[model samples]
Target: MSELVIKDLQVSVDTEDGPKEILKGVTLTIASGETHAIMGPNGSGKSTLAYSIAGHPKYTITGGSVTLDGEDVLSMSVDERARAGLFLAMQYPVEVPGVSVANFLRTAKTAIDGEAPKLRTWVKDVNGALDRLNLDSTFSQRSVNEGFSGGEKKRHEIAQLELLDPKVAILDETDSGLDIDALKVVSEGVNRFRGQEGKGVLLITHYTRILRYIEPDRVHVFVDGRVAESGGPELADELEANGYDRFLKAQV
Candidate 1:
């Protein structure tokens, strides 16, 4: 089974003021068959953690280590990390001009798999993935994330998550900007991925509402770049009722 271990992780970002630290000794583990939820307020470094693990150049790893299934994740390039089975669903999925969704998905799949999928089967799979997410088959003809609504962008990310089928998935604010119906639809896609054997999910979100649809095995309260506390599913329920005030105040 695959396991992603983060140990004493520290990260920084470059700004006009020089370097600013974001993640402070953040440590956690996500193993196959477990879904972990990271809940925090804005600027708490939740997204930073996701991006850093995915090898974003914007964030620098000042200290600590991140490993996926015993391999050095931090040392790998962004695309290398994906080929190594680490996937990131960005909070804001960028558009790829002139690249049709079908072509984009096929290229990514080929890159990750080291070969092209069978044409006939690939077409059927793509259509099925789109239909499951409530997207029309014609959606694949559009440029990736180009002129799509926020919900469509997020849904497309999940569709990729299923087709690509990585070992671990890091979703950054995936529930953001989704209406109730879209949230459920997106959540279903995430749940379907989690249902696969040896799949791991690290869902970063601001609200506990998404947790209601996709139950997390562990819930972490992130405050000031560190995980203040971690507990079972009940921890999410507590957060929904109480909020991050207690964790935020503990920092003072």
Candidate 2:
């Protein structure tokens, strides 16, 4: 089975004050087919952990190792990480003014697969994925995320997730701006991806609402750049009933 392992990972970012550490010895492991929910308050280094693993140039790896099925993920470039079957659905998806959504997805697929998908089959698959997300065919012809409403952009991310079929998907605040209906749609897309064999998911969010739909195998409570606690799905309920206050107080 495939696995993503992070061992004592430490990351830092540049600021006017010089390099300040963000992720403090964060470590976690995700096995194939296991959905891990990372719940944390803002500024707790959740996004830093996500971007660090994805090879964002802004984050510096001060220490630690990240491996995917024994391959060193920290050493790979951003595009190289994608080709290695890692997908990150960003919280703020940037727009590419000239590239149509269809072309963007196709290009990503071709890169990951190492060959172009047959045109006829590719077209059907794209349309089908879009339809499943309730996106219109005209969506495929539009530039990537250009002028899209918040919900539309998030839906487009799921559409890419379905079509690309990555080994491990790291979603950063996917439910941030989604309504109930859009949340269900996005959750359904994630569930569909989880249904695939040996696929792992790292879902990050502040609210527990998405947990109602995508049942995580493990729930990790992140506090102060580290995983303060971890348990089964019930932990999310506990968090909802109480809040991060207890955890934060303990940390202090």
Candidate 3:
């Protein structure tokens, strides 16, 4: 039932001189049970698109609107959007020193659901979700991503996604710094999240290697802050074969 509609969205970042547009007019729609991949070269605004939709303060929306399930998302605050079932897994997850993973998970779960979970029930739920992702229970006692490796950091992000279970998940380069084993674990967690009611994913990455594990229903090539082309999984194959050179050429 949940759907994300991005209509002619444009974004810019603030500068002393003036605003510098990062995302051109862009439109896309994603419904439940669908996975969409957006691929482009660096500085193509792929990450900008994600940040704008999530209402990051640094990114300014100059044009268009983003609606989730018929509600205007651009007008809502960041926490409000998350509570409304929107989740963004950043490429570089920050470290929360002195905050245990267990505490962080509980807070996120409570915040997303708008209510604190009972201790007994919450414990089982948290443990079960961690087990599904092959994460050690001891990790819960450690500081949140403080000293974790690249793969561990990514896995921690995935763990948050699983625990939050937002209706729409925007993953920005989650596979960028992960190893093979970590990638598989992260992909498996994503797979488990998919194929369910009111679930959708927007995977933003430049490499097709992640697609090998998590198949996308559609792939869109982003160039010059707009979608240049969109097609099935074969588009990913083409990108793998020829890189983004052809697409970059077409954008010029």
Candidate 4:
């Protein structure tokens, strides 16, 4: 089993003026097989936290530490952290103009497992995952996310998730740009990761729609770069009902 621990984490982004703090002494934990949702308004640093955990070079970890299954993740390079069992599905998945999906998946799969998946087996696995996402097999022949619709891009991210199968998956706004059907497809893909042995999920979103399908084990309300409230699934319902007003007021 694996665990992701964020202890006293403070993050800052570099600006011409200086380092601007985003996350303020935030700490959280996610154990294997558990799902945690991070909800917040825009500019609340929700995305910053996700990028920091994934070791994005643009963000500076001004303070604190991030550890994965007892290993110091902050000290590891981005590729090393992924090999160490961490995955981040970005809010805006990039377009690799010339890379075919099959080729990209194979390369990522090999990098993660340190062995190439057999050609026949890999094709079958990729096909099965595409079917689950309702993506056409023809997509595998096309360049990654090039000319893909918003919903298609999101589904493509889920496709990568199915292929990578990391120990922990941080989905930064996976619910964004997805229609109802696409949202359910993405949610189901995330659901498949739950297991008795363990796989952790950090779902960052602004809406409660995806939570209705995935049902996080815990919900955290982030306000002004820190967690303002933490609770169970019902917290999502409350956020949907009352919105982030109380959270914004509390931040003051």
Candidate 5:
């Protein structure tokens, strides 16, 4: 089974003033068939951890290690990390101005698989993924995330998660900007991916609402760049009831 291990990880970002540390000795492990939820207040470095593991150049790893199934993930390039089966769904998905969604998905699939999928089967697969996400087949012709609503963008990301079939998915605040309906739709798509054998999910969110649909095997409370505490599904319920005030005080 695949496992994503993070050991004492430290990360920094280059701000105009100087380098600012975001993730401080953050460590956690996500194994196959497990879903982990990271819950924290804003500016707690939740997204930083996701981007760092996904090889974003904006964040620099100052210490510790990140490994995927015993391979050095910290050493891989951005695309290399994706091909290595690590996927990051950003809090804010960026726009690809001129590229059609169809072409982008196919190109990414080809890159990850090392060969293009046959046109006939690929077409059917793409359409099926889109339909499952409640997206119209015509959506394939539009520019990726360009002019699409926020819900559409998130749905598209899940569609990618399904077709690309990565070993692990790191989703940063995917529940944000989604209404009740959109949230359920997106959560369902993620649940479907988690159903696959040996798949792992690292869902970073500020709210516990989405957890109702996709229950986490573990819930981590992130505070001031570190995981303040971790527990089972009940920990999420605790966060929902008690909020992060206790964790914030402990950090102080």
Candidate 6:
């Protein structure tokens, strides 16, 4: 029964010139077991919306409110947001040279759960998640995302999504650099998460390919810092055929 509500969200970024607005009056809702895909052209502020919801410091919420099950998200810090069951899989997953993947995942899980999972169970869970993503057992011993390929990094993100089991997941282009096989594996991981009783997915992507596999219950079109239109899964097909030209034309 988790519900994530975003109402009239207005966000801006600080630049050398001045403050530049990114998201404008964006409103949407994602409830448990619903997958919402946000499709838009480049520079349309798709990632900005994801980062804003994830409480990234670079973007400031100039207006509106976001809530998770009636709790104010704006007041929560980045870590607070995670502990509050909000997860963001970045478009570019960063690396940590010294942090083993196992250690990092356990630390993050402990932070969110307020207690460390039993080592035996946690190790089994970690290995299982990694195996599902087509990663080897040795991967857990490697430093997080260090020297991994692009597809591997994205798969690692999905593995986190599965292991963390958050209430709401805001994925910023999880399909960006994956091959067909890797894409399917990652999609399976997301689908696995969606199978849970209390989970929602906010999938931000430019292409409809991933949508074919993940199957969004709703699709929203973003253009020029605002949500231009929203509809069912059919809207993603419309974007594939007609493209954003029509939406951009409407803006002009």
Best by lDDT: 1
All candidates: TM-score: 0.99, 0.99, 0.97, 0.98, 0.99, 0.99
lDDT of 5 by residue, 78-159 (tens): 9999999999988889999999999999999999999999999999999999999899999999999999999999999999
State the TM-score for model 3.
0.97
Give per-residue CA lDDT, model 2, range 8-92, as digits (tens). 9999999999999998998899998999999999999999999999999999999999999999998999999988889999899
List runs of model 2 lying over 4 Å from the truth.
Answer: none
* Candidate 6 residue runs with Cα over 4 Å from true position: none
- Which residue runs does candidate 3 get wrong by more than 4 Å? none
Residue 197 Cα positional deviation in candidate 3, in Å, after optimal superposition:
1.8
Q: Residue by residue across 1-252, what tens digits does model 4's lDDT show?
A: 889999989999999998899999899999778899999999999999999998899999888989999999999999999999999998888889999998999999999999999889889999999999999899899998899899888888888888889899999999998889999998999888765258899999999999989989999999988999999999999999999999898767
> Per-residue CA lDDT of candidate 3, range 126-201, in tens?
8887787678899899998899888888888888888898999999999998888889999999998886776999
lDDT measured at residue 181 in model 2 versus the true structure, 0 to 100: 99
Model 5 bad stretches (over 4 Å): none
Task: Report the Cα lDDT for candidate 2.
Answer: 0.95
Ten residues in a row with the worst lDDT in model 2?
1-10
Q: How much lDDT does candidate 4 score? A: 0.91
Clashes of 6: 0
lDDT of 1 at 33: 90
Tens digit of lDDT per residue, candidate 6, span 82-164?
99999999999999999999999999999989999999999999999999999999999999999999999999999999888
The TM-score of predicted model 5 comes to 0.99
Considering summed lDDT, which 10 consecutive residues are worst modelled in model 5? Answer: 88-97
